[model samples]
Target: MSIPKYNEIMPNILRYLNTNGEQKFRDLEQPLAIEFGLSDAEIIQEYDSGNGTVFLDRISWALSYLTNSGLTERPRRGVYKNTELAQAFLDKPTEEIQIFVKQQMALRTAKQKAEKAEEGQLDESSDLLMENNQTPQEMLNTAHESIRQSTYDQIIDTVLSKTATEFEGLVVKLMERMGYGGQVKNAGTVTQASNDGGIDGIIREDVLGLGKIHIQAKRYAKSNTVGREEVQKFVGALAVAQSNKGVFITTSSYSAGATAYAESLNGTTNLVLINGEQLAKYMYDYSLGMQTKQHIEIKEMDSDFWDGMQNDSKVG
Candidate 1:
């Protein structure tokens, strides 16, 4: 069965606390998983951002909502118990409980906002109560991923519109920015337009130019698939240049035959194939053809600091 949503988990949490007495947060997870009849895989399914498991995240938000609604209390850190008010909620249907919690949370938010405004310290921030099932962190991750994908699409489109020579120069610059060429001036160069021997660009791996990496750039549309013939031609170009390393970058995917051919020559020739998706990702990661519009930092409490204070009090 699919894991229950946060609101759906609320009633079960209340019932467990009421029956089981005070419990630590970690101790609640197993029993809750059993109650939901969730498979091991479902319980451990990670969010897209790889932050935490979806099941645990939902459980955490459920507990937070219950605490804010006065249905539960944390008497000690990481330890939760049901309050007398929880008894009233235990008998209610899950839908009614959800509605009550939402209303209580709304009231709490309004009170906090009013207090902040009175102090002339009100800033634009989202309310603590989330309307969707996702936790606050998950929401932020989704937004970040969406923005990145949009930027990648825009970059690919812009690159596609440029001339072939311009595209070759761009890839060479990208290689230099990616820590190739080792601080050498003009270490990467685009070849002349005609009679370039299939190699569009080249990067000297060191200042002395003892080692070199040949580049073949193909600015093909998404509909076009680079085949083994193109890869073979690049390999021939590498042979002509007396180099064993080459990068074949294209704004389109490669055929299975092309990928297999490259893999077959793994020991004899070193070849790196960068497709449209991978190319855009590399550009975004290296901050090429894109600029940062905003940056956000997420922070958590320093348990060590509080622990030190407690130890100091004991010594006192």
Candidate 2:
């Protein structure tokens, strides 16, 4: 069975605390999963962050919602217990508990909107409330993802406007930034031909030049797609160069037939196809034409180290 939603899990968490007294945050997972008849797979499913299981994230969110709704208290770090209101809410219907938490969250969101508006800050249409009730870290992740996508769109537009030679130069610079021409000056060179058998550039795989990666870049419009015929021509170009590896980079996606054709030559000639979205991502990742505006660090409490210090303090 699928894991319970955050709101659905809230009442059970309060009830569990009411029965078990104060409990460490990590200690609540198995018992709660068992209580809800969650399958082993459900309990162990992971989120992209790799911080912990998805079920644990949901449970932590549920706990935070309850804490915000004035139904629970954390007397010490990572240890939560029932408040006076928690006992009464324990017996309440899940819907009722959810409504109370939603009301609390709505007020919080409204206050933030008012504060930002007072500062004359303009933002995208703000939601009155979020139903999933993301934690603060999750909110930051979502915001960063939005900003990255906007940057990618701008990168695609700028790249499509470049001249053929300029586009080839950009690809060479990107490849060099990806550690292609390490310790070797001028190891990446553009072919400088508009019709050089579908190849636009080449980069040495290492300083000694044991191998080379042939590049074919297409600065295509958003509506244009690189079809199988174009890929076949690139393959022919590779064969003419007597090269077994090639990179076909485009500011547009490949057709399904094109992708399949490239994959079919995996063993004979390794063909790597990078579409517009992925191209933008790699450019951004390698800092080709982007600068870091800010750096934010995400940190967690080191429980084992802190607990050891606490034990030593008691002994002292």
TM-score for each model: 0.74, 0.81
Query: What tens-digit string does per-residue lDDT give for candidate 1 at 121-226?
Result: 8755547446675667677777889988998888889999999989999999999999889888999999997888999999999888899999999999988999
Summarize candidate 2's per-residue lDDT along 1-316 as a digit string, tens digits: 7878777888888888888898999899999999999999889987554556778877888888788778888777778998998777777899898898888877776787789889998654446234355555456556788999999999999998888789988988888889876878888998959567778999987878889999999988988999999999999999999999899999989999999999998579989999999999999988999999998776878988776654332321
Q: Which 10 consecutive positions of candidate 1 have the poorest summed lDDT?
A: 307-316
Number of the top TM-score candidate:
2
Colliding pairs, model 2: none
Which lDDT value does model 2 have at 204? 87
Determine which window of 10 residues in candidate 2 has minimal summed lDDT.
Answer: 307-316
Error of 1 at 15 (Å): 6.5
User: What stretches of model 2 exceed 4 Å from their correct place?
Assistant: 1-5, 31-57, 104-132, 297-316
What is the number of backbone collisions in each predicted candidate, taken in the order shown? Answer: 0, 0
Model 1: residues with Cα > 4 Å off, grouped in runs:
1-59, 85-132, 183-185, 311-316
Give the TM-score comparing model 2 with the true structure, all chains together.
0.81
